[model samples]
Target: MSDLATLGRRIRHFRTAAGLTLEELGREVDVAQSQLSLIENGKREPRLTLLGAIASRLGVTVADLLDESAPSPRAALEIELERAQSAAAYRELGLPEVRATRSMTDEVLRALVGLHRELDRRARLAIATPEEARRANTRQRLRMQQVDNYLPDIEDLAEADVAAAGHGGGALTHRTVSVMAERLGLSIVHVADLPHSARCVLDLENGRIYIPPASIPGGHGLRSLALQAMAHLRLGHGEPADYEDFLRQRQDASYYAAACLMPQGAAVAFLERAKRERDIAIEDFRDAFGVTHEAAALRFTNLATARLDIPVHFVRVAGDGAVVRAYENDGLPLPVDATHATEGQIVCRHWSARRAFARSTRTTEYFQYTDTPAGTFFEATQTGTAESDEFSITLGVPYAQSRWFRGRESGHREVSRCPDLTCCRRPDADVAARWEGRAWASARVHAHIFSPLPQGTYPGVDDRELYDFLESHASAPEE
Candidate 1:
């Protein structure tokens, strides 16, 4: 079906170009002039017979009248203005609608469209300020906990896609991923100048998915990126409605990619065997799936409670000690601000997440038991480098479940009273007394805190550049 707005603009464009006023055209089509005016303004849907008569009078086929693209630059502007005014974002503003009429100049239309776009942009910024983003993330995290971080629908989809690609037991290979893309009718293309803002761009129009020529950094896999791009289409995602929607889509895509890399059936059987042997480990999971340690740890959370009957928590901490991402259903106490957001919040110095940074060994995973106010938990931490930044991935469970995992017998342990301020946040009395007035250090600032969210259909992407890239490669020979 044609977009009514586009159809209306096209009709008006053709009628004006042919030098026929609404009254004249209506008479030729045997319709009232007022109804014809309403149809031209996109206020009314015309019957098929009326459209055919109008097309005959306009000397064009119905197909031409139904073309999706605007008939002219002015028509495009009008269509854009109409869409913006009708959008929920605009309606929420409670502003009076401006109707484009014959008296409105092209310059005036342009100004109106531009103003609405800016207003829309500002509104989005307000909706997702840093604090709002954190709170939204916190809410999302709680929701994940409700389901034990398991998404059966996505898991089922990934299992189907992986099996269709002829994947058997072991790590999913690039060749298999290519087959998966083929099954979805998408071809992967590598380009050196891929946009930095986008991890991968799916060109649905050309049946091509463009990725950067360089190998994905930070222990990420090219298969994972391609699979994620495919997930968006398979999952029927549209432009995210808001920041929360964006976060959910992103997390779901990541979940789908992980599920594809580690098929739930094979992964569950493998984990069950490890459980039988009492030696489950993230490194082993990572090695088995040929995925990053962080990926393996997160995938474990996706299945642990739901399939293995063991609750778990996963946390990624930057070298500087800020929590990058966190999820738990194991009754572990994590530091959270008033908004309940764990991101950017500092992990306790005495906890395994922070203490792992002090380890001298870089080749092996670190294991520890931490006694927190909530309970005693056993944790396994692994350090990895991604995009030149060092970070640690920690997976933990309640002490009772430790018997089923490796590193359960490790003697390393610590006591934490976090949220108490004195546990890890407060300095020693003597140290504080000595440095209270003598020490001064400037804080490093992050510009992203105040920066607006990236602007585009896909956040941060340059739509024009992407379109040009797609056009240049639209007819290129397939690799």
Candidate 2:
């Protein structure tokens, strides 16, 4: 939603607010006054270092600079710039100043700009290509259905109930988002209260996003947070919601990383390859350029989905020790019936990122929507256990799209992967095979996220089902 003009305007407004002139701010950011002027006018965009310099000069967070929510009337120009930016990459080379936009320098810029353009363009078209959008739409519909399944019942729980069941010594409440945020080389902090206080807490470190522990007793906290995520998406670009803010947190981290990995000029040339390749998921692109997984994932997500015709999902899990981290779903019900997915178990949740998923054992399988019940995610309160608040995402992807999570693709190269390389995996760069009593007969194994425990899974009334059913029966609510 943000563009050069938005950055430029924010720079100007903040510079004025900070009581400094463009020349003065440019001096602080170590850029020439004219260059800063060009950037501020939306004719040029600044790199992270420059943006940081500008933010520092303006006395604001870079995240704050990227914050396009509630666009001022002045922000409209930036939106126009974004559109032009799309065409520049797809058609022209976009260096308005360089009449020869397609020159080498222009090619470089277009590569970087191209993905955004593709992502943007696709989202706008009434047509949903049979590619990733079709896949994404399927997932979105399923998730939304799951969300709908649980939304009306939100009134049933109390914030206190959720919080009481929530895990953590409030570490995430205090801990900043270390991985994606810091990797982008931004200066940020974790705050007890957020820009939208009483709604959720925020960590400005790395990227600007809010994290609310579902532990707030009385269920008010989780409900409020859910409302915010839904509202954020509903408002679309330049509006606020907990989900996009969360996305902003990741996207900011991912986008900046993408720029650094493939500078605008260099990436345009890369686009020509995209036409030749299937979809450039993070890993594939990383292979093209040899980058880190996190970096690739971040970049893929930040890429404008509309331009790339790629869909990225904002998948997250909060487990550490105890309740791990809390998750609040806005549109859909929380997956995994009880606790939120934790960091340690991402591989179990998503198979593509880890090596484990390819080894098909009876333990791993896809649960159909018909089998999973209406609610996809289950929020819960736990006590007397470390994993009390910890939960897993529901594995109920319909038979149609369940294969994407497998580490090996059975079919075509995707233009993009939802949740942006969203196959959950262990935080560790590499992983080994270990069995968890949990993956069923193939048995639940603790493997990396990219590796699903070797199977698409089969549904049968096994002893494990009997056990789970028995457990649920024992715990089932009273009439």
Candidate 3:
């Protein structure tokens, strides 16, 4: 490849590997998006100042460019690019151009800066050594060991947030919370079945929120809301406090935010009635939350239980590679199964096996003509029939946003745990279609482990909950 091509490829590769989007990285380096694109595409090299800015933001050193070697002309080109970047010639080499800019009034900038500082301070409080994560996980496991029946109190937490946020207002405005979530790519929500005491995973740069699943309102909002709260921290806008305090006091802050985005009182009441009636009407949730049909389905799965006393269990692996929201029951198949995934699709090939966790064996190998895919599927840990209320509910959140649930350089060993042997084969359309039924299928092919492709796309969750949440707030006169 040409030197420019190599240079651009490397920059783009490294930047993405660091987990930043073009926009987020642009903000950090104080460069415009188009200009950054040009540099990454090898159209122009960046100046020394620009290179320093980029490097500092991404937490890397100049040597990282040359660490990987090439033995030919390409090698010479890479050296040149590295030289130009190190000497800071690109800033002056690339023709300077002025562009239209968003008019961030000085007042707004000041307010934003102040808010960023507060977030920074709070994030600092949650920071601990790397070892702390293991310790925290252990602590949490011990706490939950005996508390499978544990459920948290949402109303109490909301009340606490109202009291502590000090930005006191009347009832929560869902709109505000939804807007915040949208900006940060969070999954704003309410959930049920958590052991008390909200928690967060914080690093020097960002934080992630995790409320006890039970404490939230619906059993279904787990992944979305936790994800949204984490976005607030990672994207630099969340108000941080002790995990306990944030959960209790900020629940209302989020509630207020959501209420503003969605109709609160009416939606709550209607949903309450749905729960009382054990009824699920798609239109009702869609209109209430202002979310898509898929999101609405997921949300109602949670809301239905609260409104009617139907119980739904939620488990979400929110990363990019696998099951985004893996809802399960030790019991019967849930009543919903709609997938944009197709027959002979091997989309998860390059991702971790976890991607297909909680997959229906019927879908292990998809069937246009058959009703299921082949895989080591779950047995009903509990029993209930689809026609009866005794059946446990299940839903696989193969949402679009989950395309990013990739594995890191690690976890190679973990891939072996997946029993979908067919998923491990080098995927060919014909191979994929026939693997399950073929008489010679390799039994040793039981587990396939793979890491995520580098520089992968992670389209953040725009959230289905928001729209339905809004829809729930609005009322339609009898048509």
Candidate 4:
């Protein structure tokens, strides 16, 4: 669907270029001048026949009037200014709307648009304060736990889409993914100049999904990116209204992508068989689905409790032992701040996620039983490289449930009195005493802590850059 405002602007532009008044055009098109004026002002949408008539009189085609790109730089600024002024944030200011007229210079329009952009950016940034984000994360995590992290609706959708693409099981192919997109009237365009802040840009106007030409490093593949992009459309997502909405949409897309990569029906069947043999393992699951260990670990938690009646916990820890991501409903005591956000929190040093980093071998999964304040958990941690970062993926369950999984017989064990000042946080008495008076160490601060969320229509994306990319490719021949 065309943006009614932009379409109206285009019509007005063409009519003025042809040296015709609204009255003149209306008469030529056999429409009332008042109705034509309403269309020109973007107050009303014109019927198709009337639109065709208007286009014909203006010496332009329907396509020309409906083009997604701005007809001119001035026109683009006008449109942006109008949109910004009409926004809820702007309206809440209780200031009079400034109409862009012939007297308004392009510079003034640009300044107004820039000011609105900044105002909107700051508004969004304020909503994403560290405290708010942490709370939102905690809330989202709690909700996921309530549902056992299973999205049956999304699972059904993925199953249907995969079946429509002729998938017969095993790893989904790039060709099959393309087929899925094509069936939905979307084209997957691999471009070298994808927006730096975005994993993939979905050009709804052009019906194109732009992704990086090269495969993404780590477990992040182009197929996954493409599927995630398509998931937005499949899931009926719109511009997020707030930080919580943004997080939910992202979570949904990622979950949908994982579902596509490993369809629920097939994956559950495979897991059931493995459980029957008392040989359920992450590595085997990873190999079976041709996914990374992290993907397999995360996916296992999605189904473990829901389908197999076995509760589980999953965590990805950075080399420095900070929790990157975590999910659990199995009573595993994950490290969290006051906000209950697990990310960036330091995991217990004795836990398998952190301990796996000390191992000399990355060839096999490291299994360990960790005794924590909450309870004992049997975990299988695997170290892997994502670009330059070496992280560990840990999947674990309560000690009682460990019998259903492989590596339950591993003898490695450790104890963690986490959340206690004496556990791992305090240095050894002799070492602390010697270093306290003589040692000086600089702390490495994470800049992200101080930075605001990215400023754009989409979080962490440059709207202008995305628009420019779409414009440049709008008329290009489809590959």
Say which candidate scores most in TM-score: 1
Scored by CA lDDT, what does every candidate get? 0.88, 0.37, 0.38, 0.88
Report the C-alpha lDDT of model 1 over 1-479, residue by residue, as the tens digit.
35888888899999998999888998888999999878887888999988899998889999999889999998899899999999987898899999888799999999999998888766655566667777878999999999999999999999999998888878888888889999888988888877667788898988887877646542357788888999899999987767888888889999999999999999999999999999999899989988988889999999999999999999999887888999999988887889988888888888888788888886888899999999999999988788987899999999999999988989999999988988888889998898888978998765666777665656667777877777888888877
| Model 4 alpha-carbon miss at residue 113, Å | 11
TM-score of each: 0.79, 0.24, 0.27, 0.77
Q: Which stretches of candidate 3 lie above 4 Å from their native place?
A: 1-265, 272-279, 292-302, 313-321, 325-479
Pairs of residues at least 3 apart in sequence or in different chains that clash in candidate 1: 218-386
Q: After superposition, how far is residue 56 of candidate 1 from its true place, in Å?
A: 19
Clash number by candidate, in order = 1, 88, 75, 0
Write candidate 4's Cα lDDT for 1-479 as tens digits: 25877888888899999999988888899989999888877789889888888888788899898888777899888888888888887888899999999998888888998998788767875767667877987899999999999999999999999999999988888888889899888988888887677878888887888888755432348888889999999999998878888889999999999999999999999999999988899999988887878888888988999999999999999888888899999988888888888899998899999899898888999999999998899999999888898899999999999888899999999999988979999889998887886977899877887877655667778878878878888899877
Tens digits of per-residue lDDT, candidate 2, 370-389, equal: 11122222111111112453
| Quality of model 1 by C-alpha lDDT | 0.88
Ranking by TM-score: 1, 4, 3, 2
Per residue, candidate 3 scores C-alpha lDDT tens digits across 1-479 of 23554555566767877999888888888889999989876688777778777877777776554334432343334443344343333355563422212363445444544544554444444444323433433343333323321222432333343343332343333444434344444333332322222332212222122244445343224434543454345334443333333333343334332333223334456666664554434445555555433444344343334443333333222222233333332221222213321111222332222233334442221101101132212111111223332212223222221121121111222122222445455467876697767657444321222322111011111223333433442342211
Better of 2 and 4 by TM-score: 4
- Which candidate do you rate higher for TM-score, 2 or 3? 3
